[model samples]
Target: MTDGQFAPTVHDDIELARKMLIGGEWVGAISGKTFPVYDPADGRVIVEVPAGDAADVDRAVAAARAAFAPGGPWRSMTPQARGKLIWKLADLVEQNAERLSMLDSIDSGKPINEMRFFDVPFSVDVLRYYAGWPTKITGDTIPISYPAASGGRFHAYTLKEPVGVVGAIVPWNLPLLMAIKKLAPALATGCTVVIKPAKQTPISIALLAWRCEGSFTLNIAVIGSNITGLKRTRIRPPTA
Candidate 1:
């Protein structure tokens, strides 16, 4: 297929709902506003997605924070189990690669072959690669120069832990890969994620959120919105 051509047959198997994934549940924006997502292939109206505002962003952030809280499902899960779930997500993406490619092609106006051959497969590989990191994330022991109160040198060690909730903002070009790139490592490290996919390319992310809801036992929220919505959020990375 040439750069100017679009795939003649576009699959409609994915449920193109105008909803947001908040706390692993599909729901509409609180304001009940929806925005049109255009098919760049021909500038046609592909579907309508939720126009999430500040309230919705706050809800997604809260869900992520709760998931990352102490003793929460996400925080309580074993590292090995987390890795296995990421691996499973990678497998799911692989199983639906063709459909994802087609959807991305329509959403982003990219060539079908490029999405099929490069973007989709790379996302799978990235997820698989990050899946291995959960088990490998470790800290080190250190020797302290200061003497102990009792007279001997003190023993010091560091432990690796998830920082907190992550706010990932991905661009429209190569949407699938970019989202996975932000999500894979964060999930592997036991951090809950609030994803804000580009307004033009949220359909594939919605499909991914659906698959994750079915497969993952943890919390992950993918909200749809334009730039104005998420910018209002004050996400400060946890400082040591």
Candidate 2:
């Protein structure tokens, strides 16, 4: 809906579900457990999200590996093609600006004007900026020579490539913007990703995954389990 469609307020009127996105599909937690997400401004239960734990992580990671593995769609794609996909995402983000902006504002208890005017716009810019980067990635040869084991000197050069799959674990604070920040760069670099949005605010991210699924394989699977081996920084609410 347009800003005018919402008319007097930006509070969104939409239906949200409690599920996780894995391998391009949405499903309930593997354990079938769920948690309530409340509107921060008031203590009202807005939605229920799958309570993902370690098992979910394993599923997502495996799917990501397959999508980014050699011969996979993302792996076989050219950097330019990857850039084009990212650009497409930028277009989608622009098209859904109002809805996404309103979503994060309500979910995070932030001001609508702030999210609509600043956060959402900045995220689009970041996506656009990174969208231009995929095709421009380059490497240069070094003037310094490298001596071989046999004492022969030769010029050295370096090349860059995508690092395969990526995992984007996002926070509830500014969900859309932060998600775009991580996702845009990863996609630009041709790395497939499995993104886990904060349970408290996952609607926007769920929408993003669904939107992209039409274009990419998105080998997403349900990941309610918390897989280990990654460091996580907790974001605490501001102190008085």
Candidate 3:
């Protein structure tokens, strides 16, 4: 194929989705059960993804916890370092945009041309935008006075910190872009995530895990549910 030639469209095989990524390792579902993913274009079973249960959720959470701990590299790294890593990921995404866009087109039944021209470029832009925020985050300094008259001067400052352990549950309609929109910012801000991608379109998310492997310490968990249990945890909602 020539450099400008568009690659032929290829759909994910069912067996590929059955493999679950947890704690940087690929493993089978807890119950060894699989769920069918249909091709909306024809309503045909295109693939069989793992039917994840509570055990899978637990494993993913544990892995994220390890990455979020005080001494963990993710937490200890400087914001600039984190930003650099994010930039590297953005570059990688650009490098693989064609393949990723093809996967998105197949899994979500969107037009391959649209995914190539619009969705993939938008995702890369979002990553690049968020990558610049790390260094700009700052703490506030406040003036304070002691109750006692003897006190001369006092100053107080509040530092912004990462809200650890984010559970992002995104819809299937636009799985790949949603994952990039949600996961990129959370990871950039020094938080660990357990993403429960919509069951109908799990392949793009699985592909995301594959691409993000070893770029940083991340624990991606796949669960077959619309609402994730992480909603009960201590995650702060994303600011507008």
Candidate 4:
């Protein structure tokens, strides 16, 4: 289909949606399994997306772990630097709002006009707002007293650091908006992410993942049946 002929409408066949995005790579399901994606407009099959499983989740988690490790580009960047990148991403999204909204409407079966005028623009603004917070996050200086010292001199302060490796599982209702909302805050604080977009509306999330490549260190994964496994994973490492 030509670019000008492309319209924001869900495909009639659900098998058309059968695909998986794991670690920024789009591929078929682990076992070549597929699930139907319904068109809420008429309760018809729009497409079939890859039926992701345990192994796929593991792979995505590992990718996110690597991205969040010390010395990794995402982990090594300063908070402000990371925040700036997120803001840039937000800008890109804003610039491509029309296309993104179209994708979102097609994938989620939302009204194209509403997605264009409301959902997409609001989501972009949310990302931009969160982007400004990193520059303002600062530690507090604490006053301390050492009574037993000859010449009492004590200084203490707390440093707020980014929690690493966020795994976000967004619902299908507002796939694009929810993904961006989760992504902006997590990345702004210097955390790498593995986003498991809803199986039904996975295309828009996959498109976002594709767009984010080389712009930031992000891992995109699909959650088929094992939602529980992803829920058990923590945003940060457990305290000792």
**Cα displacement (Å) at residue 11, model 3:** 5.5
lDDT against the true structure, per candidate, is 0.80, 0.68, 0.71, 0.66
Cα lDDT of candidate 3 equals: 0.71
Which residue ranges in model 4 land beyond 4 Å of their true spot?
1-18, 146-151, 214-240
Stretches of model 2 off by over 4 angstroms after superposition: 1-17, 143-155, 215-240
Model 2: per-residue Cα lDDT at residue 77: 79
Q: Which residue runs does candidate 3 get wrong by more than 4 Å?
A: 1-15, 148-151, 214-240
At residue 8, candidate 3 shows an lDDT of 34
Structural similarity to truth (TM-score) of each candidate: 0.89, 0.81, 0.84, 0.80
Candidate 2, 1-240: lDDT as tens digits? 223433343333324345666766667767777777678787677666777655566666666776777887777878787777778888887887887777777668888888888888898899889989988888888867445555666678888888866777778888888888988888788776777777677777766665666566544432422323233533221131
How much is the lDDT of residue 81 in candidate 1? Answer: 91
lDDT of 1 at 132: 93
Candidate with more favorable, higher lDDT: 3 or 4? 3
- Judged by lDDT, which candidate is best? 1
Q: Which 10-residue window in model 4 sums to the lowest lDDT?
A: 8-17
Worst 10 contiguous positions by lDDT, candidate 1: 1-10
Q: How much is the lDDT of residue 117 in candidate 2?
A: 88
TM-score of 2: 0.81
In candidate 4, what are the lDDT values of residues 1-240, reduced to their tens digit?
Answer: 222223434232222235555556656756767666665666766556666655566666676676667876766777688677778788778876776776667657788888888878888898889889888778988877667885777678998787866778888888778888988888777776767777667667655655666476453343433233345654443232
